[model samples]
Target: MTKSATKIYILDTNILLHEPFAFLNFEEHDVFIPMTVLEELDAIKDRKKDVSRDARIAIRALEDALVDATPEQIAEGVDMSQYTADHGSTGKLAIYPDHLLNQKNLTLPGPENDNRIINAALHLQREKKPREVVLVTKDINMRLKAKGAGMNKVEDYRTDQLISDIKYLSTGYVEIDGSFWDKVTNCESKTEGRDAVHSVERSLFTQPVFINQYIFDSSHSFAGKVVAHDESKVELADIGYERLMGREAWGISPKNIHQAMALDALLDTSIDLVLLTGPAGSGKTLLALAAALEMIVEKGIYEKIIVTRNTPEIAESIGFLPGTEEEKMAPWLGAINDSLDFLHKHDECRDSSMKYIMEKANIQFKSVNFMRGRSIQNSIVILDECQNMTSSQLKTIITRAGEGTKLICCGNLAQIDSNYLSPLTSGLTYIVERFKDFEGSATIHIAGVMRSKLASFAEKNL
Candidate 1:
């Protein structure tokens, strides 16, 4: 394609910080970075957070791309094909070094970095006439502002979006037709312990089902787990109602069908990775913690419990808090304490047994900042509020799991607080979609909120 035919994508600072490799996603297109974005990245590179790490990575990548190249070559653009060859992207990376405000007398309200970025895109649009100039950003308000400023083309960075509409994403359990029970009864069945395992033809289902996914009849009397499947047949293991609803994890029981499925996934030793997504008051954190306690304190399955979360600050940094690492992490771990309190109230031993259970369980509160480079083993690691994490951060955390480690990621996509994340592109959704078919992984979406009547009402109507 000609130069004018290929679109020019101007990336905002937040997009780069969200994903350092974002420039590689635009295939065969010209990627332009405003000077202000580089300045912003430089300014934030010294911080002790994921965004700072991403900024450093982006700066290093750009510097490596421009290494040994003359000023003339830099102005012309650098060939970023090598960096993006794995992604099938042939984009050329360029820096818009010229001062946009000086070149074009635009009526921008202020000299903010966002406006400067917009001015750069507008300048490019005017200079490269007829060539599409699209400003890519994760900021919704910035997109609106760009459009309001007469910039026609603006788009979201969509490399990590597994599902366009999250409302339509699978809930990990499907209600089969009424005839499913008859089909199960007729299929080859054999007793495996107390449960009967069945093999049925794939044609029995009208749609495809993922491995480890639960299939329940409309009457809710029979539930089956998809153990294995091929083009022709599916091996299903019957999940007893007793195993689903009757099983208790440290004094906590499954409150609904969604929670039942979540508990099933959580208690299964074969599944190493479990992802739980839901709205607030859906009991995601509580269920995970209860299961962890049962496994650690009761069953002696795991050596310890490690709880961590993405510390997305709404106002100021938590650095001002005076304490050691564990104490510093205490504020972010209030949910864990709350879950423990609920479990304590329901338990027979009350506060004493609760304290003993906590002590014997060897529970450790960790920040996501210090998780990298360490191989965690023989532990149940719970990553709460994962919707605030980027896909790269999720990958880093998951890859740290050592032998005999079970990683449980819990988050509500609707409650994502990160400015750069959306329900579709958050790390929680990324893992849920990517690991749906993996044998050792399972994802459950809890749709109901059982916290309280008032909380549920607010979640539904407000």
Candidate 2:
């Protein structure tokens, strides 16, 4: 906390791309951006990739930090207090000329950007002596190499990480052993319209339940969500189990209690944001698509359905593959189409049924890349494979929601494909914990797989 004790933290390019405002997170700590990091940002800024926008934003932020500083001052360090709004920042920001370091000081042997960044941290560690010089990056291999090169403090940028362990992530529901009433006998029951409402002492539960999180019995006899709570009492909307299972979306019924809870949330008109995270084949996409059709085609609650997601590395070649954005995105969005086919498989003509449903629902597939600067209104937007995205990328999509629009985000945390993301660090996990207490949001981690025996076996064993 003191000037002498304050650490020197080096920023990596990936850290900035992960969160543009990452520098301000290290309060009172002297921050360093290696000359190599700036060069890397410069190279990345002009690309058509999604990270290009982040690189530009990072550059702007750095420029703002060094606005009035002279070249000498920039090399020495500029006071960071001016850039921070919280007034807690007392450290200085500097661009370390790692390129000027003598060849004998180079610990890592390479011209690669990651190697150069690690060398910068290594030199700083030696100069700072007892003062901690930390290397922060989102890359695991970079951290390992930094530590191997004799850097004392190497860490992943954890400013946006909400939970340290994936197991601790909320499943959006809790199952009570036996009957729920049997455990909580001191319920203050009331009737709100046709629904049963109950208020019980908060101490009765072994775990914390946030707003809109379902609570149920093991027998599947009782189910409800935490509607309201005070310091001592937790209020629940005791929706009957039978009614929950009885709910249907475009002829799709709940196959289990977990699916029932998910359907109950997807069908709720009051909730604007729905987050579905579970294992592969757990009905995340199927349930979301069904709910979208039922709302758009049957209920007419929304005017259209927009499905979008971040495609993987192979999808970067889609420009050469040719066609409209929807056509190019079709390969990555096969899950949505598969769900549609499954929903209509028993119909007189499955392909005809799917075509009619697509037209009737006004369904459109747009890549998440081109969705910027557009305000989507009066529609249901399904964001699939969201676990692979960072929090800022997810924020871009979520902010595009205009009035009368609902966004459904679906993903499997275990199935994350991004090199920089894991279940704990995923945007899906971030938003699930961040929005757990929001009144208009719902998260459901659908348990078990209903896809097929082979898929279920693979999920459990492999």
Candidate 3:
């Protein structure tokens, strides 16, 4: 048996925006982009929304690289021009369709045909007579059309699922011998610079697994090596604390590596702010409150916990709110109350102490609009529902941090309530991307779904 020649891959317009480097994901092959794709991209160039506009930008970038190239080079698809490096040097980009096209197999659909993309793919397949012609798309309807047309070679672009193997990409896990387990029980260990320890903790928290010897994810890659554990080095401690004479406290306990890392990021004095992002039921708000309680009640680092989120249609102004600032905030405060109820169940005197701590720390709830006039000082501030925030809104919240203050931003990037935001251009993404290189900031993506099985299923499938 012999390997067949590379198949011709045809892409739709959405593919470029959904995954910019989509062309590169496929192996060396001939790739075709119908003229219809370019026309669609052009119509949205002036979109004010971030993601849509960004897509237009990417399409232009690709067009610029391909403009006026020689026929041979066009046949051997050229990469978009390389992006500039930090050093200002142009690093060449590996554009897909690297190989020149064999024009004999080319197909040009009618300009006005709505299904020109699919029609072009079919026409090309008939002419090319290559080993295969694969129609790739995110649209289910398009995929069905290709199949109905008897084109068996079709696939959905899996670029969004960056992880090669979803099964293996699940929360990192580790298994060790009973002997090593004893060691983990004995000491505060770092898993030898491993982040996989976080995944193991999630598994340990919600799932039932033997404590005996097994495989553990020591790092993010398969190449990461396994190591023995030391009990004396594994430190397990409850995180909640009582307020003492205007002090701080921790709300949630850290029982596993994920929570432990989350706590460390939240509590790091050098880190002025932390951002937690994930799908719903990922414990983002709960963890932020837990850390805020610890800082205000246990350590007295801040005076209060000021929590707020961008409420729908209420961001532009709070002047129309029916009550005083505090009264107006009640609606937004409901989310904070939910987290508080969770904490109260776990800690003694958690109710009165929480109230006392809130008053002592000057903790108050406000809509994002009300936050404009105040400078948060020595306070642990949490901004939830951040996906609903715009770039300007995020800048305001980040700038409000005064001396001795810390901010934790939480939201689901996948569940944006704001019409203007998509996964990539939301305030959460802007903040994360902007602060990624800053030492004073950190981002942690919570993986486990702690809310319930039904909710998790809905999130994953519904």
Candidate 4:
């Protein structure tokens, strides 16, 4: 595209709050931040929350970028490359003054902040004729309002999206035909303890399979886990249902093939990261907690279990809550308590046993707000309800894992609660796609709901 034809992206406040460095995403195109947006950012910059922190960061970045520049230079726009290294972006950043538009002639519903931003875009479009002005926002309503106001170009902020569609996500397991066992039995064999292993032709499947993915042969009632694969052959390790289901972790057994695969990944020390996606009643949290308890209390793998999650509110502020960190987190940890209850009931443990388990397991509830700048080592870190998190927040939490730490992220894409996040753009989806091919990472999608028959019916029909 030519210079005049290059699109200009007018960023919404939520875009900056969702990601502080969003201006750098537009390559060679101009990025405009309305003065109204700056006012909103200034209003919330001092709040004790992530969005406030981001607002402060955005303001500071702009100030630092415009340090020695003149008012004319600010209006004309400043080169973003001077502030940060180019990540394939040559965008110029500018702060546009609030423009008063004839709202009587426009179709805006009201004179809200969003309408003001749209009016500013409209003003820019009128000024820079033929230079496409697009409103980039994370809010669906803002995009609609922009279109209603006669702006032709509008788009979601998709710079961090890992997958375009949710259907392409990994289900973590594949069903093999009955012929798979027959072909495997014909190939070279080896014995490992009570399980038999073999190397079979890679052409058995029409598509490529991932490493550490579970394989099941429903026709022959055979189950196996993929150990290795190459162009010619795939190494399979027999994982009998009897063996997997019989092995109880904190008195919880696998209710389905997907749960079994999840447990296998959870128990294996070789795999350092596990991603589980499913519906509400799919036992994702229960299985993760059980495995963490078994590993921490029974197997002695990790020193402690650190549980954290993105606070439920889209604009979460923890200042209102009272008491210590764990006490404040207790309200959000209902799922963990429910899982503990089930484990206690299933194991037929008395109060003493529950107390012992709680004390010995060394469970710690850390807030996601305070997870930065700390290195967690030799711990089983569980990030629950991760679908609510943005890709950037998830990256921050994941990078905090130190040596010998196993990170298990659990979330349901169908039940995202964050207004700025969707199934395709969620952090859970981001990690699933980014780490699916990695050697020490595994992603599983549990299809069945084992909570109850009523819950299953509600999930499907209601």
Candidate 5:
């Protein structure tokens, strides 16, 4: 097909599934979706997930709008030439078999499946002689095929922006006005020159401001803000040497160099929160627990270690769980207990029972729902499965931390449970996006998978 004077946008199936509202974004362009795209959308009508279902819904609405119009009118409002099996061939095009347009070709196939769509575009290009035959696809292979077919243009269907560059800024000061400082004779935690630092950091984190302040890849935009900083020398709570040693302890030995570095970060008193993200089974939870135990058992720096997570969808609401408060919470706390048991088993030979260590009852478990209206102080809080939290939810959690508290948020962004959130929309993204420049916050994204080969393979391939 030859390039025409008009811009003809040939839509791909993946583009509709990725963003059903794509038509709304394209303006004044002659958009033509291959009939195969509609067939794919029809097959996904029954899917419950928003993306799959919404594609089908959008297609149906388009069909209804075109139902009352003649073929010419339908083509005017919505491109229908691709829906027809018989597209013409002239200079640079070939025709597809009539049988290819039947019901059998509706299902999703591999790269070969996209051949029919390209064929349809070729037919339209030959017949209409449009200015440009541009194939829009999220599928990389499809774009390559369009290029090979000698289409005028091929563009990726990017729905959301990608974040490529990152920025950093100074810390916030505890600046007090002259009158306010005079009224506050206590002046224990007050500091100077903090507001300027915080103001700069906050400006960098939220994306709306950064979009104008800096040039970025619209496909992937990411930013961060700093929350806290430390000028004074900071002290960390200590765990005994015996508990930190040996190979058979809690999956990874603390004597390892990487573990030692992680321990150092966790023990840094200036940092109040740690964000850890990675593939499944990276021992994030275990590492956090071990560091907290060192602080609780060895140094007794804080009151307790608080464990929390978003409630699982399978579990009934809080009221549905049986037994007393502690009993009802046992199901959720089992994972915590499992980590503790591993730590205790590792120290069995040294006669350091976990029971004795926990006898003072410094470990507490709660859910995000229960965290509201409560200010936590003197505790190390671990928030698991944080990928399911929205930006607002994350903001609420971070603001609840009082003095003498440390919080750790850990989860795999690849396996987010929240339906509306992708890796970019999740709370972990929000925290990492907002706090990247903060002096008191540090993030370590674990790339290695410690899980079995099959689990690792599934995470990578599936």
Candidate 6:
């Protein structure tokens, strides 16, 4: 889309579903919601789908803006500044009646909602004079169709995207070039309890550092955590390479340094949140399951384990299945059960051992939609396959963590299943960036695939 001095953004339904009050993100730009978009939201608000709550919120936001306005005021444009006037938003909010569109050859003429939305933007482009009318949507095909129909400005809604590329995401570790000890000239070293800590000058490092981020050297000798830092100094808690590699969660041990770092963070009672991101066979789920078992059953740090994930439109499909929530969700949660099976595969009574472990751990399966309004205390929440979730959805789950509860979010960015989300806008990416500076949160992108040689080759080449 070309730059414009002033512009009007036409919002699509998916934009609101991705973010309920997305209009607030467009600071000072005029906003238009096509009538068809409202109709779609209304049709969706009463459904049993997990997105129905978002649809209701979107409708309420629109109503709050136009509740007091007359029909003429709404048609012309409502001030819509009641919510964000202090944030420098000066643009008007209005609704365009696209049902009355009679334009000939309206963009691959069809009664489909996407076609209607494209035609609405085309109508605005023709009537709004030189002012740009940009169609903002999360649908790629909708954008293509709008552009093919000669609509000049079409774009994806990206107000919530933090990074343009996935590689820029933090991996919770830094590799020193040669020797880390050679760079530490001035340092105050001390032993607090069993931990060896050193306060080193901040100028020794050339890159930015974050709390709980690991620092390691190729000398195969030194490994440490950034426990604290300030403008002039950074504090490091020394963790021997031997200790990290030798750490155990349940009966599982780290196969590599990356997994070792993740296990360290997971086992730490001080850290409340841990995020794991990697490819398909990177051992994210396996390590998380092991840590969860250790915390809940062995260490007695957390009382239970609650596992959940965002399955696209599971609400409708789940109703037709039989049995309880966990039993019905078993098909989707096969990965977790598979990890359990692997954990006890060597036992003579493997099936009985798995059931005993489940009972002993107090494991429960829950849907993401039912997480709100509940305080999860004294539990370890293992949220798997969350690459497709939205930031709002993640916030709901994270905030559910009450006292003595820890949350682990695991995902592979390459396997995002949501049409409205990309690696840049995924909830996992958003949290990994948002919580990098948080003292109680640590994120690790596991390095290699441990599933099999063939799985690793497929991940790299295919």
* lDDT of each residue in 1-462, candidate 6, tens digit only: 343567999999999988888887787788999999999999999987767989999999888878888988887888656753245566778899998888585766878999998888988899887888899998888888889889899998888888778888999998887788987899999999999999999998777899999988888788999999998999999998889999898899999999999999999989999999988888899999999998888878888999998877745357677898888777788899999998988999999999999999999998776788999999999999999898898999999999999999999999998766789999999999999999999999898999999999999999
TM-score of 2: 0.97
- Cα lDDT tens digits, model 3, 94-135, are 223312334354343234433566666777677668457888
Candidate 3: worst-modelled 10 consecutive residues by lDDT: 238-247
lDDT of 5 at 312: 65
What residue pairs clash in candidate 2, if any at all? none
Model 5 score (lDDT): 0.58
Question: Residue 363 of model 6: what lDDT?
Answer: 92
The lDDT of model 6 is 0.88
lDDT score, residue 340, model 5? 76
lDDT (tens digit, per residue) of candidate 4 on 1-462: 577978789999998887787888888898999988999999989876677878998888778777878888888888877875446667788888865556674445465888889888888888898898999998898898789888889999988876677887877788876645574534777998987887888887676688877788767467788788899888879888667656668778888778888988999899999999999999999999999998988889899999988887632666578988887887888899888877887455566666777789888888898899999999999999999987779999999999999999999998888777888888888888888767799888888899999999999998
Give the CA lDDT, 0 to 100, for residue 118 in model 3: 67
lDDT of each prediction vs. the true structure?
Answer: 0.85, 0.89, 0.60, 0.84, 0.58, 0.88
Q: Model 5, which residues run further than 4 Å from truth?
A: 1-258, 314-316, 347-352, 451-462
RMSD of each candidate relative to the true structure:
2.5, 1.5, 10.3, 3.1, 13.7, 2.4
User: What's the TM-score of every candidate structure?
Assistant: 0.92, 0.97, 0.52, 0.89, 0.48, 0.94
Please tell me which predicted candidate would have the highest TM-score against the true structure.
2
lDDT of 3 at 367: 70
- The most accurate candidate by lDDT is 2
Query: Least accurate stretch of 10 residues (summed lDDT) in model 6?
Result: 80-89
Ranking by lDDT: 2, 6, 1, 4, 3, 5
